[model samples]
Target chain A: MVNDSELCEIILQYVKDEYLDEDDDTQIGPDSPLISSGIVDSFSMVSLKTFLERKYKISIPDAKATPEAFDSVNKIVALMKEFF
Target chain B: MAYADKIREAYRKELADIRTAGLFKEERFIHSPQAAEITVEFPSGAPQQAVINLCANNYLGLSSHPEVIRAAHEGLDSRGYGMSSVRFICGTQEIHKELERKLANFLRLDDAILYAACFDANGGVFEPFILTDQDVIIADRLVHASLVDGIRLSKALQESYKHNDMKHLERKLEEFQDKRIRLIVTDGVFSMDGDVAPLDVICALAEKYDAMVLLDDSHATGFMGRTGRGTHEMRGVLGKIDLITTTLGKGLGGASGGCVSGRAELVELCRQRARPYLFSNAIPPVVVAAANKVLELVSSTTERRDKLERNTLYWRKALTEAGLDIKAGESPIVPVMLYNAKLSQDVARDLYKEGIYVVGFFFPVVPKGAARIRTQLSASHETAHLDKAAAAFKKVGEKYGILGLKKDQIIAKFGA
Candidate 1:
């Protein structure tokens, strides 16, 4: 089983690579705001869910896929842990 | 006056914020009817300029067809204009009944009920069927706003799967097995990407889960299948869809009307309980007659749809050969990917200067960093029009140095 830090690292890396501009130098941490800081939009949030589901073999229901649950890597990790 | 004065400054600040965020929508007034070519006045007081239209939903080119216009005139002369009352009051005319029957026959469903607009049809469809808290409404994430609203009006438990992700949908279906009822909702064709849904798979999933399926075919009804029936026909699942909501304001005749076509029992329930049908005025007789003529024409011949298919193939090929990045699909909606929001707007403005009328789609409409110019093909466009549009697109593509560039390359240059 993937620990919380490893899962957070995976999600942070995916967001940075898929959403951020190539030259963007803003630093992202485990607790950095994704949606609040405009790093991820609604569509991007869905894609992140898909990525996690494919990576970890889990299905995140629509109710649990709320914006607040996906605002930070730690929150997302917590949400995924419920399904696992 | 006191209330207006109190809130005027706040409204101004809100408008200013929208402008600052580049989210304000500006309208271009069309001086002529919607067709392959039309005169448009941009920036309010500007002189009208004629441009080739590539942004309208006129797939079958019946919006300004001479026969349809003539039919509208005949209907106007015969039936008179407005139905002042809603259906079941004084609004139920013979022509209205005829149009609904013709639409039902054309879609191969048991029956159909009309609405003032597809928005109304979608807005009022769900509450009657997905009744009670034990029912669950599972929909695709990318369904249109109308469907989203309709689903929201229901008191049932709401759920959604990833867009076009069948496995995810199946998971949802399996999870909801213990629910009293499961209704799966999806768009027949996604408007932005132009991709058709996998209805065959969806139907099988519904069978396995004992669920009902609803399709919003607003984008694909006029020219999607072998006989232009719908995506149900294209996916070879006619009569299998439990509900289908479509619009006549688009490829049908480009007028203003919509319908919910499906099983007779559900349609009866809608006629009785769907608030839009019972509350809104009837669809005007002119539009009804014009739509009847449209259905008659489509039912009689595949000529227009055949031409549309050819035009779509030719347009997609031309754009691909021009080295522009575009989404791959068989539908008439072709999105030329520019990746940057401002760049899409700039390219659209440049294309307008080149006499091509297309609009840029940016963030919030689509996802961030996925901005594109959505170009739609129509049967009205001749080869010369297609050739001109392709050349102009290449010119704009060259001006922006976006030709032959991949998504990452374009984003690297423009900062998506």
Candidate 2:
């Protein structure tokens, strides 16, 4: 089973691969704002929730996947912990 | 009395907060008809300005067509005025029936039922069919707000996949395999980004999952495909969509009615049970006659839609070549991305000063950071109108220093 830091890294990598263009040089840290910063839009945020649910076999409630919860890797990891 | 005063104070503070956050929306009064050029009074009492309109839903530019206006006058003279009741009572007229028949034939569906508006059609469509908790509705994440509210009124389990992501939709279909009925609903074209749904692939997925598909083609009804049959025709999935709800308010003559055209049994079911259809007043006879004329025109020729396509191409190319960030799509809706809400508003306001009529979309209408000025093209727009609009956009874009900037750069500049 993946630990918290590993899960965070995995989510971060998934976001980077799916959302960011290859030429984009913007640095994304663990606590970097995603949704609020225009990095992850609402539709992309739903896709992220789907990815996490499918990968971890955990269903994140819609309420739990709010923009606030999905705004950062740290926050997402915290939200994921509830389901795990 | 004291409670009313407290409520008033609360609302006053809320409105003040909206203004403080630069999110207050102001309306523009249009003096002329909704066409390529319109006279507008901004901020209520300001002097009127004739601006090149880029924000209306008049896709085929039939909103103020002379033929359509004549048809409305004829309808008014013939059908009297109001229905005075709902369809179940006395609102159903001969012209209404004829329009419904013609619409179903045009849409290539078995039958159709009219509603007061597309919002009413959407709100009433789901509840009648998806009757049990065993059923499920899997929809695109970025569907219109009407669908959201409609889904909320249904008893079925509601789910959403990523927008236009076939793989994600397939996974959702896989996960919900045990559901009694899986209804997949999507807009024919997403208005914000001007992207068409991949209905061909969506239909295939629905077939594989043994599900049904419902399409809301409000944005693509009159000018999306080769023969103007909407996205289903454009995507080569004609007759595959189980249900289609569309508005007469947009591409279909810019009137005030909507309809649910679909399989015979489903439409009959809505006719019998859809609350909005059974209760709301029938569409005005004038609108019905005008819409009938519209369908007749679109059915005969592809002239207007073709012009719209060419105009869209020219406008999009012009904006892109002028170094503005434009969302790429096939529809006439062109979104000029301005990521920051205040930046979008400022750019739109400046463009208005340059005699271009447009509005900035921000949070609540769109996502918070995905703010944009959605510029729509019409067949009414001539080359001169498009040229002038593009030049105005370029001027305002330069004023905001947003020309040629990438998304990240824009965000970095404006704090999105």
Candidate 3:
């Protein structure tokens, strides 16, 4: 079972590798505001939700697939825990 | 919860979420006419100083050209304000036909037909021309929202390749060859990034697959090529596209009209069957007349187009030298990419405070973390205006620390 920090580490790598554009160079922390900081967008969010569902075996219902649900690594870990 | 109440409560939650996410769209109304300089009101109700306008689609600066405005007046006098009827119901005027003829000549197409707007033209195109089960519509993933909606409305099977990926397009074309008809549609110039389509490759692929090509050259039609005949001319595929859709809202006169122009039979088919062309009220005579004047001006001399290209190159260089992460583009639309959404908004606010008017683009307008403020150059923007805008950008960008990679980050990324 993946712990919260491990989950955060995974997400941080995913964001740096996949979501961030070539020109962007912002540092990502557990508390970093992904959406507000413009490190990710709606498409990125959708991709993240899919990643979470696939990797963690936790489905994010459409209602819970919002910024409030996972705008930060901490929030995403918390959301993943709800299913666990 | 009761059914209606639950629905209302769900919608209320969604609205609240949008506000929290900063994705809610906000509008700013301009106080002056569309030009190089205009006044606008901020959301706080404070009157902003006259700003050097850089956000408009006024490519040729004909939005407020004296000649175009006078032509509008002349048109009003000679042809009246409006027809107040659909084209089939006594709305088609002699001026409409004349404008269509001029558009055909301008595009070097065999014929042309006018529509309410390019959006309507896109909406009406696929349904009439290729609405069948075996008819496949292949599009670039980033084609305009209007074209996507049009494709959705048609019964044709839809397939999209990666944006501007010719290899992916070839694969899709090969896979869909078993389909009876394949229609490939793409934008001549994608508006968001100001990137010209690889029209030459697309045309060649169309020939190989025996497919039809449609180019919505809305952003390119006014002043893109050597003689401003749009993407086809720019790409050296002049008069090769099967169908073309373009707008007057941005290019010609900056009023309102659009046309589906191309080969005689294609245009004639659209004129006879396209819903938007048949049901929508005719293009107002004044707008048609103003557009005619704009076309006349464009045809007579390449002066405005030349000036616009020069302006685009100058400021793109200026902004890059100033250390802003400006996208190097050939078109007049230059985007200053700010990865952080809040930073994008903050930078735009600071620029506005410095009397430069540009809007921030975020989220759905572009991919996530790719927020930008698109600045459009016009022939009307003088050197002084360009210098002022660039200076303002430099100032605000420094304050926000948005200019190129910081010294420390640069060292870290590059390894001193």
Candidate 4:
């Protein structure tokens, strides 16, 4: 089972792999602001949601696609914890 | 001392910015040809088969038409593949002139000039003719990116009105009253939103403001309005538009080409001055011939357009009746609003799993909180295909709790 910290790490890795940016200092933690900081657009949010759902086998309801659930790596971890 | 390293660092930073902002775009590989049914092969070694493609711009279903294919093959035999030179130099073939003439006749325009892509057609327009400091170009905020790029490259004073907001447009026109020439540029049908422009009203305003109207009918040509003559025909203001640009990529047979149609003088001016047309290699004879065949077919019968209209109405009505929030429009582009980006993505994935191919669009393709599954209707789709697609939507909506449980369950229990 993927723990919250592990999940955050995995997501961060996915981001790093997809972007392949060497100078980016974007850190993934519970308090990281992904959407609010304009770090991620709606399309990336969707992709992240799908990645989580497929990776963790959790069905993210439409109602939970709010800023509180996806605003940061930390929020996503919290949401995953709740689902698990 | 290390320019390459510095450039790489900048690209890395840019990539990080894009990743953080969720602006990263990925392309799906469609292994098979673009048709009503296509096969997409993912990197995971999974191949998915989808029916009645809802994302292609093959509006009149002429991309793989037998007649079009035949014409292309004939052109390949007659004119060879490519000219290897720009039109004025040595690329101007008899068939290119024939295709241009046919397009002009089809659009009911005095003349027309071809471009490599609609992007090029737009990119080459405003720069040459409208760059004077005395000129002003008032454009819709939601015009295609190509138009925006062209306007950016020009020296004309630019003013943008809110998307489809006639009042804002009128205000902009009034504000540009002092310019020597004021050009009102807009898309005949906004592609992403699938809403038709009020060309009649716009023409009236242009007349009142003494401004010329330019319509990019990329989404409307060979599809919208009666006989698929586009927005001008739909609004009964055919000749009123000063300049019109449309893609041969979409409804005009999915050939990789574009054309600017209007008064003979404007077209001649573009032919002479438009950098893309003057410098770029002419469109291959195969594509030109195929487009000519498509024009001939669209002009001959309204069958394809009528069928597409029927499919659009059926899909829109059925989806709406099932309680799905569909964007209001009479065009073939129907946007099923799922508001939530995650839900929209899931719904599209689920639909694809059920053999109905569609794409989920979110910002910056649309505004925030307006994510949707933009489903396009083609003349190639039959009643069964549309119903199947709708059924897939109902299932996905139910699974994701987007639609009412009872209604969705009822439909799912009794398979359509």
Give the alpha carbon lDDT tens digit for every residue of B9-124 in model 2. Answer: 99999999998977776777889988888899988999999899999999999999999999999999999788999997888999999999999999999999999999999999
- Sort by DockQ, best first: 2, 1, 3, 4
Candidate 2's C-alpha runs over 4 A off are A1-84, B1-3
Model 3, B256-354: lDDT tens digits are: 889999888878788788888887899888898888888899888889989999999999999999998877678888988776667678889888889
Docking class of 3: incorrect
Ranking by lDDT: 1, 2, 3, 4
Model 1 sits at a Cα RMSD from the real structure of 5.1
Highest DockQ among the candidates is held by which one?
A: 2
| TM-score leader | 1
- Please give, for residues A1-84, the per-residue lDDT of candidate 2 as tens digits: 679989989999988865676687878888999988777765457557766886798877767779998999999998888887
Off by over 4 Å in 3: A1-84, B1-14, B406-416
Colliding residue pairs in candidate 4: A30-A74, A39-B20, A39-B21, A40-B20, A40-B21, A40-B22, A41-B21, A41-B22
Error of 1 at A41 (Å): 6.4
TM-score for each candidate, following the candidate numbering: 0.88, 0.87, 0.81, 0.80
Q: Estimate, for each residue in B106-168, the C-alpha lDDT of model 1 and write its tens digit.
A: 999999999999999999999877798588888887899888888768877777776788888
**How many clashes (backbone N, Cα, C below 3 Å) per candidate?**
0, 1, 1, 8
How far does residue B237 in candidate 3 sit from its true spot (Å)?
0.2
DockQ in order: 0.10, 0.19, 0.08, 0.02
Instruction: Give the per-residue Cα lDDT of candidate 1 at B32.
Output: 96
TM-score, model 3 to reference:
0.81
